[model samples]
Target: MRYNYPHANLEFAVEALNISDESTLSSEDFATMMPRIQSLALRTKQWVTVIGGSRQVIQQLVNAGVSRSRIRWVAGRDADQREWATEQALLAGTSSVVLSFLDALSSPRVAQRLKMASKVSQTHSFVFRSLPSQSPLH
Candidate 1:
């Protein structure tokens, strides 16, 4: 697996990668694999988001080394908020991956706008979804 380790202290996005973490590596060694978290999840994209993911899921990913700096963690405080954040990030030309559980709540109108934005900005978007949500709609 690959990883992306952008400098947190730097003013600009400096893309860096580490391609391998051997079998003998320890938990501390995984810090070396932190960028691997991003590269594996993000691919050619620049960011990853946990859209409508429960708080626990978001926390676990962070504990597992997906840099908090690289994630736009969304708890669905509301659907509009998540969609707005997505739109803003896409407008800023951030290539992004979304781990979405609220598939039905996605805004097609917002998505259409994002489609235009992505085309204009030349960005990439990917969504990794498996289990669906059971939470009652508000």
Candidate 2:
């Protein structure tokens, strides 16, 4: 679903991208979404933190027109660390947007914590997950 950025305050907005497999995120999947992401970064001119993203993915953002200096690519040692980093980034108010790549949210409390942190800091958070196919035949 599309989120209205202008009215994003205090809202737990989520946008999911469909992928061929639930275990991996392909370059093509991210490439397709680059334009929108790039536009948001450029328009806002704010720092963006990417948690658990690869070097290639970060390069793609730079190649897509986002300033390399404005992007912070974080590689957490583990899932828990990644979640912690995401929360800290939001709560610290150092980034205007935080993109997290995870297999799945560990728990509802995690989501609640993220939402509350985003709300308090007024930072936009986007969580990208590789969900199992919804098709019954899959």
Candidate 3:
């Protein structure tokens, strides 16, 4: 699959997809997988938000052809960081966001805030509710 950027001198060519053994793969391998995934994202023309995940995963998506303008990385942290990240994510209408550690959002109020951000963003968004780490507080 090849995707031309919506507006700009950018394009992505993608092929091959392997859903198995993703964790075991090295960083280099992940880099190779990125383009394929990004092609799918481009085809959808929707904002992709990754919540509760790692910066590495988000970076991989960027490498795969996902535009920075269409990505946001958010992880439920404390009140201030969460609010700041949420605001930034919403402002970035077409960017993918990585919201890591969903458990950090222990308040209903925070959840409501996230819901509002989702509603206002006019692009495709994705949320990663979990990551490789586990917290006792959660």
Candidate 4:
């Protein structure tokens, strides 16, 4: 299924983007997400923070048409650090969108914290997870 950004009432929302493979982050899926990212970036003119994204993934986002200047790639080596950074980015309200590629978000507690933070800061957040044979923003 194609994932499109919800155009209305986007604030205070935290969603998930499930990927089947992490080793070979599929370009097709990443391409599908670009439009939403681009739309959010263009609409808000704010930074989009990417937590736990590798350099290759960052490059893919740039290749998919998101401006390099508008992206803030945060590569936290520690899982706790990455989760903390993701929450902070959402709570800070400096970024219009926060995209977290952390496995730790699979935890309900972590996801809940992020949801609250996004709501409090009114930031649109997307967390990427590795789930088998599924690729959709839920």
Off by over 4 Å in 2: 1-29, 130-138
* Candidate 4 residue-wise lDDT at 133: 34
Q: Give one clash count per candidate, in the order shown.
A: 4, 0, 24, 0
Question: TM-scores for all candidates?
Answer: 0.46, 0.69, 0.43, 0.68
Candidate achieving the largest TM-score: 2
Among all candidates shown, the one with the greatest lDDT:
2
Indicate the TM-score of model 1: 0.46
Better of 2 and 4 by lDDT: 2
* CA lDDT, every model vs. true structure: 0.48, 0.69, 0.47, 0.67
lDDT of 1 by residue, 1-138 (tens): 333445221222222211111122232433364455455554543666655555555666677656667777766566577566655655675544444433332545655664555444444433333234547777
- Model 2: residue 68 alpha-carbon error in angstroms: 1.0
Which ten residues in a row are the worst by lDDT in model 2?
15-24
lDDT of 2 by residue, 1-47 (tens): 33345644332334322211242344345667677777666757779
User: How much does each candidate deviate from the true structure in C-alpha RMSD?
Assistant: 11.6, 8.2, 10.4, 9.1
What clash pairs does model 1 have?
2-36, 3-35, 3-36, 4-35
